[model samples]
Target: MKILYINAMGPYEAWPQAGVFVSERVAALRKNGVDVTACSYYQINSPAVQRVVTRNGGPDLGTPIAQQAGVTYGIRKIPNGFFSAAMQRFRPNFWEKRIARQVRRDMEESKADLIHLHWIWPMGLGVMRYCRETGVPYVLTCHGGDIYSDMKDMRKRPYILKMLEGAAAVEFVSKALLESAKELGYSGKNAAVVYNGIRTSVFYPARQEHPGKTVVGFAGVMILRKGIDYLPEIFRRIQELIPGEIHFYMIGSGVLREEIEKKMAGLPVDFLGTIPSEKLAERFNEMDILLLPSRQEGYGCVIKEAQACGAVPIGRDVDGIREAVDGFGSLIAYTGDDDAFISAFAEETAAYVSGEKPIDRAAMEAQAARCSWEERQKDSIAIYQRILGKAD
Candidate 1:
């Protein structure tokens, strides 16, 4: 099968967390004997664009375009400058406008059997328009943020409804995401759940010795959406109650680092500062728990990554997080109930810390293995085959 797989970000090295699923899936499909052409938006913010376009610094396009692993990777540059900026205002969906020409170009050039789009917002909407006009078939996959953003703000709800309506098939990372879209009036018949897969090769059961400390770690950008405010308060409360049984380690940096530092002052916290993906599994292995009280998620692949290393996860029971933590870890209600959250965290890790409840490393590893990319691709190829048969 020949597939044109498109998404908002790419080339894994530049946007690791955002591009990983696509990158990995492309490799998996290629391994299974599918001809896949991967395309992504090589964008820089206006400031970076100004720096490059004005000849002040290097170019704004991220990561040099490459073709590797039997998959031809393509880059679509979003044009810059005054006329382009003015041109953008005329379009209701700015991203759709930026991506339309590129999407059309890709479609005409590829002669692909199917087009698999990663998100509903920009790429899917553009593809929807193309399919409606050109009679080409494409599939849409909702990866959390794309659908979640429109759920609260009804301005772009029609675009989402139309995009979902036109797709030959629709995919979701979790069942929760599909239901949420239905709440937004997505009555699509072809939609199904395909959980995001973890790299078990990097993350597996190899418990590192932390020696008398119940290390609970948080690994993600420190931002408002990650439920960052709740971290400091939870840390203080847990420390006051548990009193020296736990040590907090925060990973990844963002705009709120200094603010979080100020709040976490004098606490037993270690700011390791953005560990690389290859080295993150080592950190997970040392942890007894992975605490990310995120406000929303499509599916927390990090939860599965940590679980593969035998670190139980304790997070908010909302969106995709609930499914990721269903049988593996603990989930507190999404009501932002601090007391309830802290209690769940304490209960989930306390027994492990005291050695009363043994960590079922095999069980956790088994759960993580079940969600591997290799396993998920089987279903993806099945979808591709079905869509192709219908197209024939």
Candidate 2:
């Protein structure tokens, strides 16, 4: 069966590291003789776009390069200027119609059996429109921002809900997100939870002898949602509990980076700036702990990656993160309360520091190893087969 995998956030060639997760899934399916062709919206990485894009983080939308994976895909550039970019802040109503047309054209030309859409957005709405027109089925995967952040807009809520309800099947990265969708008014019967996996080849236990203080790492767009604002309080509490016991290294850049850096000045923190995904594992290897005080998540991919690299995971006891840890890492502070978050961090790490319950790096690696792209691919293909009624 011809399978079309659509990524709304990428032209994968430019997204490199982030793109690898999708490419790995495609490659795994390909190995099983399942025909999967991936496609993405080509981002125009110009100076004007850079101003907006970097506001959230660094150039995650890097320059589009030639596909080095030896597999070609449908890569269409977003044909819009500053105005279109500004307007698409809440919904891509303008250029999305053209993209929707492209999705239909791609499906028709490829004779695709099904379409796998990454984000249930404005783009997913377009795909839904196409599916209704052609009677071709499409699966929608709801990543974090699409549901949590996008759903807040009353104008876009109807479309997101429709996409959730109209999907041939809805695959949520975390069970909490699935429930969130249902709470937000989706009575869909055909929904499932498919946890994300890392490329094990690139991420694995690689800890060396680092004899200094315990190095804690934080990676992702530094913003309110990621709990960047909690840094000062969290750090103060951790230090009060275990003085001079931890040092921090932060990755990714965002609107809060400068303010956070300034606030964290004179502290044992190093703002490493935004590192590429390919080299992320190297940095993970240097850390003894990975701290992600995120208020929200869609299956903390970074948490798993850190676990795979032998870093003890520490984060909020929230939705996707809860599943990502899978009883392997340390999770505390259920509420967004600063004191509770701080106490949880201290309580969770004190044992390790005191040698009462020291970190077992090997076991952490094993947890991550248990579920990977290979396993996720099998589950995904099974779902696809079920959807298409293809026993083969």
Candidate 3:
């Protein structure tokens, strides 16, 4: 079956680690002999648009049909905000009508068996409208922000609700998010919880190279929400308490990088900036433990990826991480509880180093296996086939 995975976001080269997971999952599906196409609205204006694409790695729209794992992708040169922009200037009636007509044309040419949408908002809703017009089956996977943040946006909600109403199935990464969706008027029958999966083969546990200095690693967007700002103090307290060498390895960069650098000024922390996701396991092999004190998370892929590589993760107990970790490594206080986090950081790192409780490679591989792209793609393919075979 031909499937079109629709999203609006980024220059695939700069995609976040999670984007790598999604891309690999789609690649896995294609390897299983499924026809998959992607429509990424990459390089769009607006912070919301960027967040979606950045989170999902706008697929390689420039990929040739063969290079794209039997998938073709395109970037819409026309941004989706002309109507809202024109609304401020003059009557938006003509522009609004034109958008509907153009959306219909795009859908017909694509001719997808199923439209699997990620991040249902203004752009996603357009896909929903086309599905409704053509009586095509569509599914939406909510990855936060779109539903939780923009649900109240006037133009956004109507489309979100329409998408919800028309979707053959709806998926959220977390139970909290699923609950949020139910509360937000999504009463679809096939509403289900599907956790994001990872590539365990590429991200399996590795042998530790450093046994002398206790290394605490972190990877993800270096934004305030990730609790990167508190790393300086956390490391300082760790150094003082342990009185041993405590090295910090931070990966990824964002708006908070400059400010975080200012805060950590002369500290012993090693900021590697952003490295490709494929290289993370190598760093994981070097590190003693992974730290992700994020204020929020959606399946904490880094936590899983690190754990898969035998780097025990110390994360803030919230949403996806709480569910993903499931008593694996250390669970600290929510991002606000700095004191508790510092205390836990030292204790956990010590335990990890002294072999009090080493990361269980067998258990981690087992857990990681449950969330693999191969497994997820199987379920996804089933979801598509079921949707297609359903009575219209």
Candidate 4:
């Protein structure tokens, strides 16, 4: 079957680490003999677009790139600020017709059996409109921000609900997110919880010998949603409780990097900007624990990545983190309780230092193994086959 995977974020060469799961999924589907292709809207600040903007000294709509994987069409980006938000709120369908026009053209050209839309914000709405007009079936995957953040604005709820209702199937990365969709009045048919998967060959555990101190790590975009502001306080408390030299490796970069670095000064933290996937796996192996205190997460992919590398995951008990750490690691603190979080961190670190809470490396690997890309591919293909009423 021919399947078209539509993503707002393009999985391109410029951003090596971006859309990793999407790339892996497309590759897996192709390997399984499914004719799968990807299409994305040109991200405004993407490396390619930024290069053009830098050369021209202004934003310009450029030609989209066509590759064996799929095509990426350029689209106007809403400017960042209050004005943009207000415009989006007031004129929700401002870009809908344009995006849908492009998507409809692409769909007709590809002659796809089904379309799989990644996020349900602007893209899903447009694609849903196109699909409805042409009587083509499509599945929608609500990846957190679109549902939890975007849909929070009642203005966008009707469109989101309509897209969900019109989908051939709706998939979420976590059960928590699925429930959240239901709570937001998504009474859709063929709803399923399909956890995101990791490429195990690249993320598997590597044995490492620690000479003295245990290292705790955090990997992902260092943003507000990640609860990075709380890291310094938690680390400070953990240090006071544990006598050993504990070090923190912050593995990713974002808008709050400088501020977070300033706040973490005088602490044993190393801001390792951004490491490649292979090196990231090695870094994960070096860590005794991985901290992901996200205030909100669609699914904590880092939790699984760290776990796959045999690092024990310690995260806030919220949304996807709660589910990811269910059988593999420890979940600490009620969400938003700083004091409780500090206490939990202190306890976990103290136990680790004392060798009382040793991580079960084998079990961690096993749990992570269950989340392999091959398995996810099989599950996804099964969903597609079911949607199309065909047998494998």
Best by TM-score: 4
Clashes of each: 0, 0, 1, 0
Estimate the TM-score for candidate 2.
Answer: 0.86
The prediction achieving the highest lDDT against the true structure is 4
Model 1 — TM-score against the truth? Answer: 0.86
lDDT-based ranking, best first?
4, 2, 1, 3
lDDT of 1: 0.74
- Write one digit per residue (lDDT tens) for candidate 4, span 244-273: 577889988666788888988998888987
- Candidate number that wins on TM-score, 2 or 3: 2
Q: In model 3, how many backbone clashes occur?
A: 1
Winner of 1 and 3 under TM-score:
1
lDDT of 4 at 211: 69
RMSD in Å for candidate 3, one decimal? 5.0
Residue range 148-232, candidate 3, lDDT tens digits? 6777555456556766777888877777677776777767567777777777777776666664677777898776668787687
**Cα lDDT listed for each candidate:** 0.74, 0.75, 0.67, 0.76
Whose lDDT is higher: candidate 1's or candidate 2's?
Answer: 2
Q: Against the true structure, what is each candidate's TM-score?
A: 0.86, 0.86, 0.83, 0.87
For candidate 1, which ten residues in a row score worst on lDDT? 57-66
- Cα lDDT for residue 20, candidate 4: 56
Tally clashes: model 2: 0
Superposed by TM-score, candidate 2 places the C-alpha of residue 121 at a distance from the truth, in angstroms, of: 1.3
